[model samples]
Target: MKLKTPLLLLLVALTSCGNKPDLVQDNFSFASTQLKQAFVEMDAVRSAEPREKQALRDKQNLGPLASPRNVEADGTLHMVISRDWTSGFFPGELWYMYEYTKDDFWKQKAREQTALIEREKMNGGTHDMGFKVYCSFGNGYRLTGDAAYKDVLLQAAYTLTTRYKENVGAIRSWDHSRDKWDCPVIIDNMMNLELLFWAFKTSGDSLFYNVAVNHARTTMKNHYRKDYSSYHVVDYDTITGAVLHKHTHQGYAHESAWSRGQAWGLYGYTLCYRETGLPEFLEQAKQIENFIFSHPNLPKDLIPYWDFNAPGIPAEPRDASAATVTASALYELSMYDPANGKDYVMKANTILENLSKGYRTAPGKDRGFLLLHSTGSKMHNVEVDVPIVYADYYYLEALLRKQKLEKEGTAIL
Candidate 1:
């Protein structure tokens, strides 16, 4: 029943995902009036775009499902359609839009965009199956309970598990060997565990669940530093399972924390706790939160410099993507911890507010990207200070989470 899949390597390394079902009671109270303007404005912006037609401009990025990348040399916004991790995010965006508005236009667009990336379910070479498939199809299944989406998701999990090594007790993150990296695992890989965990729950398959658990445990053991800040990449010896090297592929230095990488770790482990109810995962999430929020470099607006330790400090470009992810993770984190949840809820609200004003794009502008100022790989000198699809995806996701928490007293992770 499991069909075999893959992540971004050149553009990103092990791009992004989660865990068990938790019985959560939402007790927090908040007024949801402010976000509706952003929601309505963004919806109108998205509705105005001919996304399906524009996506056809770049088959290299995957085709009609391509999301906006950045401005090309011609001063027009460029879109990319790759088997890259971010490909599925566009569809996920539409899914969220549908969820938020209950409009048939978003629903139809979601289906069309989702259909373009179905081939990725069989792409087993990359480790980003969760970002590629689950973000799109997983949402589809969650919303519609379509059996076809379920099949795609199950096959995607099977493909993802192929990358797991019993010796390493982790799924290999990158296939390429750079320097002495024989088997490289990036922190971003932590985000891919959601698909496997979801598969186990839906199919009653232990292989998927066990692999997800082991990978989370392994990453938890090795990825974190003393302050709970994380290394972006950890290479391992295939046979001995020893760490070969630790470096930041996208951060300022090998020792610096990449903001989005930190976001990935926070979101990933928090999700693992949601699925497994493991206290360790929750504690890890807290430690990560402490490291990020307590860090002196964090802007008062909650958006972070591309790397917390980037040399430029305040001069560095802020990564709205990291802020969006952190806010989204914090909203989910608020569900389980009574002592910290209130603070997290406040933090999440502040982030949403800052992003809506400082980072939001006007209607019919910036290629209809929801949030701006996301940095992709500052090291590669690409996608810097640009609108990124994942930033928007998580931004909308955080907004939806806030809306749900306010209205139903429940956060849907």
Candidate 2:
């Protein structure tokens, strides 16, 4: 699952080729073109389904398969149902498109896709309400001020709180794999706290705020090592509130730094600082930034391998998803840390440029996924090197943030 050596060399060359004045704008234009074609192809697949199947889906109240998760082994579109954690990302991408282009077409498409995930507002089986709902409906609400979207977000926030265990001081991450973990809380759960924060601000509920802060504080204490590299999963004794195990579930080993987990910690703590103005959260984010950018294993292009400690070095698969997340977090972190702001922006820009130049799917290829070579879970041998939905979501997000920073000197949007 390693990237071809020739492609890796080309990526390095492209990263060193220097930046262009219109890189963000040009990439946005390219993304819009590619996504339009993707939408058409996706819709065709939905339309080609048998009438009986469609009727049964309607009767069962199953929403249309509106989100593109990834491409299957045969290169067919792998669209997912509403409950999938990634279901919100495609709609979020459409929202970013609308935000960038201000086109009614993208806005209408965003609305349609966002609406499909509304049923997940009550899905508390997993600790990914933010990924499954907020990225879709939350963005929709942010853009349109839609009252219904607001209601759904608040309800989703309440449902997410159901997973919170006061004893563990964290939201339970998984209900399955009971054999492996008592109360597993993964680093990825940090990303879901955004929904709770937003709900607190919107609904004036201290419960939402407290749960988010507790989770952040608890995770800050338990999930990270002295070097600020994070474990992928931290199992806890649910009743005793004591740490039971620290597992690198998706990484190279029990103690290796999972690339995406590091990105999540960096982004999550940065966001926590934004929401709560806590110096500790800011410092944690900075430590993670240093760890990622200073790591010798990080590629010259700023795209990290699937695991920072993966044994294969140059031959390991790159995770474009991690780069996208890191780039997006850096744009926000730059706004907060002024002394290093320029450097963070420069690194983020390099990542975006390298991704655009080297990792992007060829025009009209891979069913129009924006980028390639993301590893979802290398340990499980899943999605080792492929185009993932969240990579495209965060790529669009980073592009939008870059544009905002350029125009307004702020990356808030």
Candidate 3:
């Protein structure tokens, strides 16, 4: 069958991914080239689009799919701003630029973004603040030793800890509506648990770590489907503590896998394994990875359709954003499984190469946003096939991971 070629190619690709020092050296050269290119792009973006004028909060007012291209739809370049759920991701993007190039321009943007976020703060009662803020700020403080970043991150962590409901033994999420849903949990929230776990170590607050672990356990028990693909949303009864319903808000149906959400589960559980060393978490991550990689319908690039099972192929389109997230997750997972790490590394490499080569704009259409063809909340029918800020963030993160692995003389595919 024609489809068999990619499967056969996957096996063949795995062979070259062995523990060859030359592979590491080759990867290092490639990564260095890309990093240098990223620096060039970041500097160009910074010079062209100054941070103060286009502050972080500008993202709030913009409509969906409202990228820098949104300027075209409207007369003024009304940049969206505000500390929303997607708030933490922008800083992560800037931090990646700073980390790779040591560019003071990126650092200044990151600092300004952090200050703006802390000053207003988002609807902090939800669990996502950890990912949207702490992952950016926590990682930022760890890298720079900047006390201001530390202060803002600590405040955000404290806000998250305060929301930990002892009754449900988990953190609550999204309180704008749906009042009856007391102990609401999302698989996406699992990635945010690392922020709390890190907060515990940074601040010596065991409660934060304990809370994160409990929340993770609760999610593992409730969210995973029979096939190991996770649900987008799980409603837990605040009183009886039973799972009320497992649904998929972002997917086509309650059972369909939202590609990015699945990536979050794969990435989050791997993170849980790293933090707790629990075999179950790693086991789940591996199972999810198998489901993700083994999907026959995935494009040659390995980036998944927005909903893998969504009817219609080229007409419906795949979410390059999901592929980017999974690429970074697979790269992180590769570190733990040396024997099979190459398969993941190869998959990650496939995704990144395709993204950089296929999904990236021609460097002329969009000067500000880096990667292209990212889907943001396709269920709500918004931001289809445009640059998502977080997609650029994860794409850069994957690159940094490759850079780190190559520098450490590790195998890279």
Candidate 4:
């Protein structure tokens, strides 16, 4: 059945009144059972280790916002211990865990880890303040209603805006030397626009909303190919906003589709539609959704190779990070497109099942990071086939979203 309205009624519509109600409910019930088991396994990992406690106390002596990134060969938790794009994911994971398990242990850890990066609210040198701050404090405030978290989020939103180049109509993504990139705007920047939207909604400041819409419009004009597969980076002339180049720093080639960039574009546009109720953004999202599901190289499990055009085919690395991000995006998108809501929800559930059963770490392993086999930069030969922090963050997020739908028949707000 094609959905015409997406809401809490979707689960009921599928299982209670559909053609094969029993079969549908049975499969959905089993999927929910498996996810509940995953929740237990994750909590066990957290309870078995004091790693986060130690990291919190030790990070002060190491560096700023020292988020745990991955595990070392010796089974020690490798720390970011510096400014990087992924620093907020760990804390965001903690917040979700706290919300899921309702354990004070995770709540305290979430608070501690979130506090470490409080300074990113003022650091505008890079364009990743959203990833570093919003995912941390944004979830924190959403769940806890702490006034302090609100203040930090607003500050980070403002700091993120400082990177906006009026001429380019987008935020500068990288801070490489002036000669190297006149004004670089990456597809990943789409993920950061959520903070700006939140800023405007919460603060009643249209400045934040205007910049975000402008950036989205500019990216929609330039970043996409005819197929809705996106370029990784679009460099603009700093003075006149003219196109300088469209390049791929992370994918297989300049013309290939990078899996994670595509996920970001899908999620970003879905989010833009939710925030603005704009038909164009929803159409943009559905276009990317169809591209991802119809892509020739997508695996049976729905995970994509690091690059859709990568030469290695089945031998190329499967990106759990991209899959997790897409799972979360699809779950949210399902709530908006009723005609395809059942398909979207079922696909999201399938992705969660694959990750929970196939890509998840053995408990008490992976330095307590949950998922495995995420590729960071396969072209650069960095962090290939290893567990990554952002992968875990989105995995937990998908879990939570799925759980919400299972129980309350609503998407996570």
TM-score list, all predictions: 0.84, 0.93, 0.80, 0.85
* Candidates sorted on TM-score, descending: 2, 4, 1, 3
Winner of 1 and 2 under lDDT: 2
Deviation of model 4 at 55, angstroms: 17
Candidate 3 lDDT by residue in tens digits, 1-413: 35588888987778766644342234333434443444444445446765654554356442221112221222222233344566666667667667766769768867766554564233555667776677577668867998887777777777887767776777877675586455667778877787777778788988888888888888778888788888888887777777787888778788888888899888888888887788888888899999888887677778788887777765776787788788888887888778888898888878877776677654434435566677766777766666666776677778777767656844221
- Alpha carbon lDDT at 381, candidate 3: 76
Misplaced by over 4 Å in model 3 are: 1-78, 120-123, 179-182, 409-413
Tens-place lDDT per residue, model 1, 226-256, is 9899999888888999987888999999989
Say which prediction, candidate 1 or candidate 3, comes out ahead on lDDT.
1
lDDT of 2 by residue, 117-149 (tens): 999998879799999898999899999999999
Best by TM-score: 2
What C-alpha lDDT values do all the predictions have? 0.81, 0.92, 0.70, 0.82
TM-score of candidate 2 against the unseen true structure:
0.93
Q: lDDT tens string, model 4, 217-310? A: 8999999999999999999998999999998789999999999999999999999998888898999999999999999999999988899999
Output the lDDT of residue 84, model 1: 68
Name the best candidate (by lDDT). Answer: 2
